[model samples]
Target: MAAAGPGSAEGTTGQSALAAHLAFRSAIGDVSGSTRRLSGELSRLEASTPGIAGRASGLFVRYVDHGVLQLRWMDAELAAATQLANAASEVKDPDMQLALLRRAGPRLQAAMMGSLLLAVWLDFLHLTDVALKQHIYSVEWLFVDLDRVQKMLKPAMTALSSGESGQVEAVARDIPALVGHLTREFAATREAMRAGAEKLQKILVLKESIEAITLLSALKFSLPSLPPSAPALLGMSLTVGGDGVMMGTRLVVSAEWVEMMRHLVRAGVLSLPTVSAAVRIQAGQVMMAQSHDELPKGVCDALGDGPEVQGMHVTGRAGAGMNEPPRHHILPKEFREWFEKRGFTGEMDIDQFCVKMEQANHEAIHGGGNWKLGRTWPGEWNRMILEALQKAETRTGRMLTRNEILDIVAERMEEYYIPLKFIPWRGP
Candidate 1:
């Protein structure tokens, strides 16, 4: 979950921290293990960007925040990577394990750090316009370095196999050290990334940190004086020693997803803002005040229907959700830049666009407001899109050209930009 996707424009530091962890994870493994603690994370998201399924800050921040779960996810991934690396070290074929270790480990370390840095930059909400490019470059370097080292290991392995086990042992001694060397290089990248991020975070005056317990500070828990602070929204499970004092460690514990849900409900009480959250405090007093249950309507609306992941698309296709790849195109500029500038030029796949449009409409048409488990977050998200488009349409205060709006939105989605729902800039 790249922080730039959609939703959180604020892109909390929590998001940055998580992205750092996720960056590490992508090289290591899947994000689901960290998802084990979603209940608490979801509650935090709701508190920060309520009704995101309805009206979100922006796509970038939304994804950034959604990525906080990735930090915890890193706990599991770090554990797995460390274990695998350790096992590879112990193998009788030290040469074989060393090869695997060198090939995959360094790149994983490098790319993950790069991601973490990007997340930090995003959370600060600087020129994502810049980060868009920087992120790709930094991560690209990660893979480049990784592939280089992995490729080197092949020849090294070939040489070792021609010798005795003592030679293999000699090479094995260097395995961890070589991997550590890569790790050191990754750390340097991480530092450079941090500098870039520090530069980025400097650009914005962010809102107060929203916590699951504090919800939103504006939406106070009580009628009058709201709690002054957004206490740390405790992780659903207080602790899990996933990494076990090696590689790196962080708290990640497993709990029933349902239990996690209950944690959100309780934490929700604390999360209420001084104003609107105050309304919920009164319970029945403020029907206008959106309640926890009321949170569902907009959420249901957003998760309407679509594939969860999507790929990059240089060529514009209006309805493509993420998982799909960018249609083949060789433009002078990247699709992201063209998109940020409110321009789209090059060959687009119209047939695929029509199919995606039909699919999106069908989901909106048939699925109506059906939400699966843990998907409450997406409903308001879709509403954010629908409403933003509707709002953008209304704001122009004229009979706008349909083709124009569609073109802008199609570009926005293509670049994986943020919560503008649709595009904010109306082309001339």
Candidate 2:
């Protein structure tokens, strides 16, 4: 009989996550290796201009940062998997294994998604390098490949996390097919870049050739995975024309490109804590471009001052629904400290707690938005605050006096709502 592979996933979630992590680490190793090598080569090469050199150096920094992050995540996943495997060795019960697997479902999903995206990003970097060296604009075609890979894997990611053994197996069976497609597409992209570079070299004038190099430098700053509509996100079909020699360099930003960027930020891929700081800073640039004046007349006409064009600076959607809460939330450090100080030793599920806070904020605004510090707390607001405090105390074996609870609620409101002057009500 053949030896079982890590992907066999015949056991529980921990086993499945371990299997997925190992497989992804192995698969991503090649891409990571290439990026490491190229980054070194780029660092050593002396660019013709300081500008070009700066851009090359920037790409190298990103290459190093991304590689480090990928390895860190892989190591953490391995540690978790190994620890679980050891514990599972002692527990003979199948039910216990299943429970462990369920516990691991989230990490497994993240491992698979992160690995697949990293591979795609590495290929994108390689393509960008070739485009600069050859002065041919063939990198756009690679987005089609990236788009296909993202679409293919997203469904698998969903299924693996669904907690059904059969579904996970079904998804696992598709990995080889997925890998095959990615390999084929990347191979095709490299070949195209090589051929395009060779052919373009023959016909390019000196100025146009130099322009290609410059364009490549600009492209390096565009992380293939950062934007929402990034080819890695949903896939992209970009049109390219006008070599700097024949035409005045046309790089048309399409509607799809704009939409992709929105998707990327909204999805929180750009907001990974390690990367979110830089991406969020640039996020305003993206949002600013969507403003009525900056957008194309056609897009502006279609949107007509709509929220899509206006953009939501604040985090939530308008109106009420169980699903209307923000998609992502990070707890304020002060609030966490207050909780800890009160002896709440429970797992701090920031996301769930943020939802409750948001709902409370929403109600406060709805209740005439009359929330002011040192004033009588609204009935509904008081009820929600007490419930949250009681739940936390129950979970953590901590007790908070009524006054303490009120103080916490007051502090929370001051930070989250007072600045906005939560009074939505205005006299006519």
lDDT of model 1 at position 244: 17
| lDDT per residue as tens, model 2, 113-174 | 34444444444444444454545653344434545555655576555444332344344333
Model 1 lDDT tens row, 299-402:
11221212210111111222212243222111112233433343232212121122112334334422443534313444333333444555666888854343
Candidate 2 lDDT for residue 126: 47
| Consecutive 10-residue window with the lowest summed lDDT within model 1 | 269-278
Who wins the TM-score comparison?
2
Q: Model 1: how far is 87 from its true place, Å?
A: 3.9
Q: What are the Cα lDDT values of the candidates?
A: 0.30, 0.37
lDDT, candidate 1, at 287: 23
Q: Model 2 clash tally?
A: 7
> What's the true lDDT of residue 234 in model 2?
22
- Steric clashes per prediction: 46, 7
Q: TM-score of each candidate?
A: 0.20, 0.29
lDDT of the structure predicted as candidate 2: 0.37
Q: Residue 205 CA error for candidate 2 (Å)?
A: 20
